[model samples]
Target: MRPLTDQEMKVVLDKLANYMSDLKSLIAPLEDGDRYVFRLNHNRVYYVKLSLANLATCVGRDALLSLGTCLGKMTKSGKFRLHITALPILARGARHKIWVKENGAQPFLYGSNIVKAHVGRWSEDCPEHQGCVVYSMADIPLGFGVTARSTTEARRLDPTGIVCFRQADCGEYLRDEDTLFAG
Candidate 1:
């Protein structure tokens, strides 16, 4: 893993900015930090660790700061897909956040979706299949999810059903298993 070049930075930021709003504001400060690339089998993963604790505090003001990798992605096919990491979320915050109740936090941290009943708050205008940030009631981001139904349809459905499809979660990053490096 190594630092990204100017061209590489532009490519990544461009793709990420398209999906994440206010990305420019969040990533601008991070540009000065070191970015490392990890080639895992067929995927190219990139990550940037903020240089200081105050950087995260300035962004999200969260506690328990450590050697966490925020603002990371794995290249799929020829493009990059966002990996929900702590630092970036704390730094820039997601444009759309789906807040789930306490009962749902465990499931969500394990990559489960927010059922209609568990969903406490969601971006009202987020459409189906759009990527969104999933958070706990305390405002700590759990991971990423793709909206499964339109807001109107979701609201009309029963509370027991799933509202979004979980894509990634915090546990993946926190796990100590060798799966991440497995071939």
Candidate 2:
């Protein structure tokens, strides 16, 4: 394909530059021609998929952010049909867990023989509220959108992604792993 015209390129670059910080709106309407460059967990540069329309395009620096941040954003309500392509990590040997709290009336499901569900102070004590449908380690997989349960008493939310990396270089996600999330 012919290169983008000078004017076309400028317009594209400007959109990219403008959508720098927390550009949620821009991302929401991104089209086939739109582009983005975001970082993996360890600040590793990676191109994002831009199939907003029919023709595919490339997103170079100035789009993506750390994986931790991205997953956190998705945890919110009304997430769009997002597409992501990146290196997949090896599954953790231990159990996978995620902690969640509904923003409104508590969410529940009917089990074979249960009528009770978690109510007030939901997620306050994971062990408690046995009736509610809170997140569990066994149901989760290693990837984005997995919110980390607070490791501390504060119970604050930390959106984290499990990327495979050595001790010295964590969060550096790879495009394709000969080894893992990063080279």
Candidate 3:
């Protein structure tokens, strides 16, 4: 319902940059027509078009449950947490990715961390602790998580070793139904 402050914008961009190598490339398409803009409402950040945002101004903040795509939410401690709703945008330009095997897909969707045995493949040169998107063998994005080891290090990890730490998963949309869309 309001524009993001300069500092807040920086934080959001920084968090996004963790998934994509180029920040401008990630944002260029959204701003292509100059019709889209980012807005903040009740700690949640939305990517909405200018025209819709203009119209939304006429509505009271309390009544505006949501607008556009919910990219993520700003936490109480000032950290930005990317939401599962942002999977499409993040997957498009993801710098590093981990593809889970068919048998592992169910567990990952259920919020379990990806184990080394379940890793079907991963981006080359992926570094330790880097943010990466998780996908199924069929190329469907299941979630996003942080790497537990570097590419080389993972090569020597045991089958039971944790490969990716779950951050957010698509299943949250159903599991968190009550609060996800609540204003």
Q: What TM-score would every model get versus the actual structure?
A: 0.67, 0.17, 0.94
Give the per-residue lDDT of model 2 (tens digit) for 1-183: 123345544443333332122334334545665654332322232334343211322433343222321211111232211112221211122122233323211121111111122111323333321112223233322222211232232234223321111111112233223423222
Top TM-score model: 3
Q: Candidate 3 residues 94-142, lDDT tens each?
A: 9999999999999999989999999999999999999999999999999
Backbone collisions counted per model: 0, 8, 0
- Candidate order by TM-score, decreasing, is 3, 1, 2
Worst 10 residues of 2 by lDDT: 161-170
Q: State the displacement of the C-alpha of residue 132, model 2, in Å, after optimal TM-score superposition.
A: 20
Residue 69 of candidate 3: its Cα lDDT?
87
* Ranking according to lDDT, highest score first: 3, 1, 2
lDDT of 1 by residue, 13-119 (tens): 66565357775454454455653332222233334343543243344323222234435444544455555553354325565668889998888877667799989
What candidate 3 gets wrong by more than 4 Å, as runs, is 29-32
lDDT of 3 at 9: 96
- For each candidate, the alpha-carbon lDDT, in order, equals 0.62, 0.26, 0.90
Decide which is better by TM-score, 1 or 3: 3
**lDDT winner:** 3
Evaluation by lDDT, superior candidate among 1 and 2: 1
